[model samples]
Target: MATVILVRHGRTAANVQGVLAGRTAGVGLDAVGREQARRTAERLSVVPLSGVVSSPLERCRQTSRILVARQEHAPGTQVDAALTECDYGTWQGRSLGDLAAEPLWSVVQTQPSAAVFPGGESLRAMQARAVAAVRRHDAAFEAQHGPGAVWAAVSHGDVIKSVLADALGMHLDLFQRLGVGPASISVVRYGPHRPDVIATNTEFGDLAWLGALGPVADAPVGGGAGHGAPRADEPAARKLAP
Candidate 1:
């Protein structure tokens, strides 16, 4: 069996503001977000991680960096686009309240499978992309590190839940039932036959008694120094398109 640790990125301004950031370029972790990531890193220090993979999104990338930097593992941690948040499509940048005020938003919440985002992706599309990414990551880890290799993937809340739902063999419509909080950790095991979930919605500091390290110093929270657009060479995971 191979252990996969799924981590949701720290909180972001968009998250706190109730805006759908999707694939927006500038959205990142705020102060509280940074602390969340650091705490996550401190907690996972006890796991014998062989590799760390992250979404190219600033939020997940930042969290992955903090975790890996604290680990004794060697360099070359991978950043892939496969681990990205759901593309909110036309809903990107719109506040939840504003969207809720619109009639179409009701359809999205009530009938997501059939409701299409005006000029954007549907929930079905988002689930497909997210599930594919998780499968791909699992295959890659199995091929490279063999069984029993513990790997960590830092990604978005929605994305992580979607993946968990897939692993659980649940329907896409039940995605809402899986809660993935910022900087929270979920563990899954992929064996020769099937995938099994070990835990969910776990906080970093809560595991301090497990002997995991504490948060690092001066790590940027909420958001980090802004960067240019996500690298073009990276595979496209779901994104909030323009």
Candidate 2:
């Protein structure tokens, strides 16, 4: 019922070094990341946010802080584990170059639904949980703030991508084709008819339009189970790469 704006956390040292980072603690944003977070915050400052939800990681929390600080009413920030980085398991802290050598790496890229990190969660599991968390929060926030209210969730790149894939109703394997740069913004509004993706991986634009509430610009009202289905002309799904 409400619009949830997904913002991937700013770049980090691990990002610069090309490490998986995973759930490793103390991975704060690098200098470039701090600036990215600030710029993203500034871009969103003109809009009114009901709240800011962040992954329970230093990077996401830091990013959330920057965004909430710039808001007029300064919406409160809360930590949600559902938005945390996908547990990379043994791959944690390993450089992507080295991970690329592993046999499972290709599976991760092409068939994530079947890929499971040794000693950690599968990509499919990550996507499922992340989507569920987002839906749960969307319902809660909509109940609290009303249909037109806007909120933000600061999360990891993969986590946000997975959420996008779910919102688009795409298979998890296709998520890699979707790129989520650090500090990018993706917008989604869950209505009675269907979930509408307003924007994705946004760099810059006027967001004041999102502050408007009640009755989305497009999409029809609800009727039944298929009410959320896209229009006949709408693509069944959006894919990035073959």
Best-fitting candidate, scored by TM-score: 2
Measured over all alpha carbons after superposition, the RMSD of each candidate to the real structure, in angstroms, is 14.7, 8.3
Clashing pairs in 2: 148-213, 193-228
Clashing pairs in 1: 23-240, 29-222, 29-223, 30-221, 30-222, 30-223, 31-221, 31-222, 34-221, 34-222
Kindly list the per-residue Cα lDDT of model 1 for residues 17-136, writing each as its tens digit. Answer: 888898889777899999988888878776667788888988888888888877766535788776776666677888988888888776665565666677777777777887776667
Estimate the TM-score for candidate 2: 0.88
Candidate 1 global lDDT:
0.74
Q: TM-score each candidate.
A: 0.79, 0.88
* Model 1 alpha-carbon drift over 4 Å, by segment: 204-242
